[model samples]
Target: MRTVFIFMNEASQAVEIPKDMQFEAVAELEIRREGDTVLLRPVRPNWVSFAHEPTASADFLAERPCVLKTDYFDLSGAGESSEEPGQ
Candidate 1:
């Protein structure tokens, strides 16, 4: 394990992370304190990564007709209700 020093200014504090311990430019992280230890965890985005080829055709949706189904949820409301305990 490596140890780094934290610097403080008049308003805020900063920690100069080494290049090897740095995250991506667009990466998001969450800092939490558990007892006396501080943890840095990455917050993953709700998205999927895909690549597009210039030579490939855009007939993916046309080949699959079942992708246009609109019956994804139950409109009958037969599940558990979301009422509060006191209500």
Candidate 2:
């Protein structure tokens, strides 16, 4: 396994992808976290994940009033197996 370093870039952090570990063909990469583990995967051509990817503002997950003003996700009782369609 190769080693890398983390550095600052503007307000976020960036990992210095070593020359040998670089993905030169891809312009962008998806970096996400799962629990305590972080994963970095390359975006392949015609990737299915890009076709219908979920998008939101950078702070959309935040509880800030300005960021989230509506009940975008307050569908607590909307869908249920017992409920009828178009009810």
TM-score of each: 0.45, 0.43
Each prediction's Cα lDDT score? 0.73, 0.77
For all candidates, the clash counts are: 0, 0
Model 1 — TM-score against the truth? 0.45
Candidate 2 residues 1-87, lDDT tens each?
766788899999888777877787788777889998788888665768677877888888577447545766777776667967799
Lowest lDDT block of 10, candidate 1: 46-55
lDDT of 1: 0.73
Give the lowest summed-lDDT range of ten residues in model 2.
Answer: 63-72
Q: Model 1, 27-56: lDDT tens per residue?
A: 668889999987887875543432332345
Cα lDDT for residue 75, candidate 1: 73
Identify the runs in model 1 with alpha carbons over 4 angstroms from their true place: 46-87
Error of 2 at 69 (Å): 61
RMSD (Cα, Å) for all candidates, in order, is 12.8, 17.0
